[model samples]
Target: MSAPRLRVAPSPTGDPHVGTAYMSLFNLGFVRRHGGAFVLRIEDTDRARFRADSEQQIYDTLRWLGLTWDEGPDVGGPYAPYRQSERLATYRPFVDRLLADGHAYHCWCSPERLAQMRERQRADKQPTGYDRLCLGKSEAERRALGGFADTPVVRMLIPDDVPLTFTDVIRGEVSAPRPDDQVILKADGFPTYHLAVVVDDHLMQITHVVRGEEWISSTPKHLLLYRWLGLPAPAFAHMPLLRNADKSKISKRKNPAARLTWFVEQGYLPEALLNFLGLLGYSQPDGSEIFDFAQFSADFEWSRVNTVGPVFDLDKLDWLNGHYIRELDLAEFAGRLTAFAGDPAHADVIAAAAPLVQERVATLREGLDMIGFLLVDEASFAVDEAAAAKHLGEAGQEVIAAAVLALQADGEWAHEAIEAALRGALVDGLGLKPRQAFGPVR
Candidate 1:
């Protein structure tokens, strides 16, 4: 048999979340390792929040990480028109079929009614989804409620008391309370994500449903849909959530690295970023830690990845980045560093400082700070606390002034010589111990 078909479907919205990259890397690695086709599906059905720029970002970010898809919007595959929005015509037939089979019914419940229903359920300490209010509506009543009205949505009637079960690849043997009924199609006539995801997964022949652990609760719902549609449920592997260092949900609002753009701006190598993300929930089965893309793929046995939320330690990631950076040849490093540097005023200093900071830094911003002295026009440079104490005090002021004058007299304008001259003045001329003199400068 051909390798199992796998995919990463991401929603196009505002900023590209690190979560998207994390999930993409996992799927890409898994599919590639098994010699399966990896597909990219764009789920942009939520037209209100849809952004045109998001598509390009998705393509750019994934390609930047060297995660190429066998099929996508930009590339051809068996699943042509690989976007959910373009497949609305396909969805309508399934909705109609569900209604005709009596597996689903017309839901004419209004939002006001839903709110009231939720309140009643809350008072009774019961669950608060739809109450299937329109399930019992007469044919005449259903006809009356029809004709471009917002109330006539389509809902699947879920059977009660049949304990639905599916073996999860991560959290095994998952189940949930089968709902009385579910809205397969909203009043606006758009399919809900639950309906769309299941329908598409079946249609796409996706073998593995690799996703985050939060979706573990929803697995039963998907399982119900599969059975109702008379289709086999795909194997699932719900990987752990990537968390903040504080163990909270990883959020883009709170963390810069949570957004991929920040990492791109900071000049993080895409491969390094991918490797760091992989380390979040997985490690070598034999206990090896250092992993590149190929190594990660070689060791990606789904059973080895954790089910608990993995802490996104940027410090740990920085260490990984250092490893990736060291592995890169200087020419390759220089090319990448140039891209993120863009049009900075002091590109020369940055170029010079790149190698020096290469061994010690995690980000290009850190390297910029190392060459800061070259870029800083000291004529206009104001005194920060250290600069004030080190150069502005009575003794410090005289020494700095003398040093500046002496340095100005025979200056080859260079950072190293300038630093050496300043040190000589402080230690030799000022009669200050090196530690005492450099302490304030530092």
Candidate 2:
């Protein structure tokens, strides 16, 4: 078989989501192991929502996590202009052909009429979609009417009551035939994901389509598109959804989406985050926690990938990060810290946190956390103001001042000295135990 070509196409809008990383890692792994090529494509067809630097950010975020693709919009390939916006001219002909062949039709009904029909249908327990207002019109008739007046959208003809079956690498024998004939091209002259993805994947030689379970229900529409276009369909592999601790799919507000920036800011090693994502739905035979891309690529098996969703457990990630951190030598850790410390805004934070973070910090990856306190530039910390108020009562304040002063007297500034002085302040000044003094500060 030819090397399995796979593409990871993400819509650029906001922060780089972990879903993008998860799918990209899988694609990169599959292609690398099989000597196939990995392609990066940006689906920025939504002009209004398209961000200026978002495509660049996708590249930056993925590369930060050590995930790289062979061909991309930035890095040109045989199939140049990987951005879908640049490919609209390519999709226009296909849309016209589908319309002429009766495989698709122009929908002229306004949204209000369409919504009223859908509401009535929903009120009567029926599927609500386009009522095919202009499906019967011939090409000449549509042209005579000033081309449907609204720039015309192309929708596939989804026949009723026919089952569509496609094999999933993880879940075999899956079928969802006769899905609602979804729109292939919008009136804005941009191809919908359904059309753009199908056409690009075929043109780019994508052999496998590995994505989250969320797209499983929509596979029929894609499969139907392949059949209608008479093109070979890529093998499908729906990696299970990632869940939070409560068994719900991971979300940004509820849980950190394991974004690349989040991992970088948290001081997590790229290798560690890569390993964590690698093991999420796929793991080694002996349950090894840390694996490099080479080891993972050597062992990758699509068949063993889990169908049951996995949880994005922060505690587990912390443990994994700490493990990678400990594996680093003191010099390497300090180098990483220095890189972040070089940031002028974060410099003071690391300076203040230097004594506190010495051996206690699990990852230099957390340089942002060390400097997070400085963001409040008030005479004191604000967000963590409650931190001071919660523990630093009037008497506690006296002990802290005394301790800071006690250490100030000695020119040798060290954590051991500061800690010893603080301990003395707790016992001699506040008459509190060492734990009691530090407990409130924490």
Every candidate's CA RMSD:
3.6, 3.9
What TM-scores do the predictions have? 0.87, 0.86
> Which parts of model 2 are misplaced by more than 4 Å?
138-149, 253-259, 342-358, 362-385, 397-431, 439-442
For each candidate in the order shown, give its overall lDDT on alpha carbons: 0.77, 0.77
lDDT of 1 by residue, 309-415 (tens): 89999888787777887777776665556556565565666666677777887876666565556666879766577757665678666665756665776867787
Error of 1 at 259 (Å): 1.6
After superposition, the stretches of candidate 1 with alpha carbons farther than 4 Å from their true spots are 139-151, 177-180, 344-349, 372-399, 405-420, 427-442
Model 2 TM-score (2 dp): 0.86
- The digit string of per-residue lDDT tens for model 2 on 1-442 reads 7899898998887677888999998888878888989999999988877888777878888998889988999889999889999888998877787777778877765556666778899999987666665778866565564424556677888877445777898899886635666888887888899999989999887889988898887898888778777899999989999988889888766665555577766667788888888888788877887888888888788877988999887778777777876777655665567575556555545555555554566666464465565545677655456766777888667666766666667655776777777777666677887766775554
What are the clash counts of all predictions, listed in order? 0, 6
lDDT of 2: 0.77
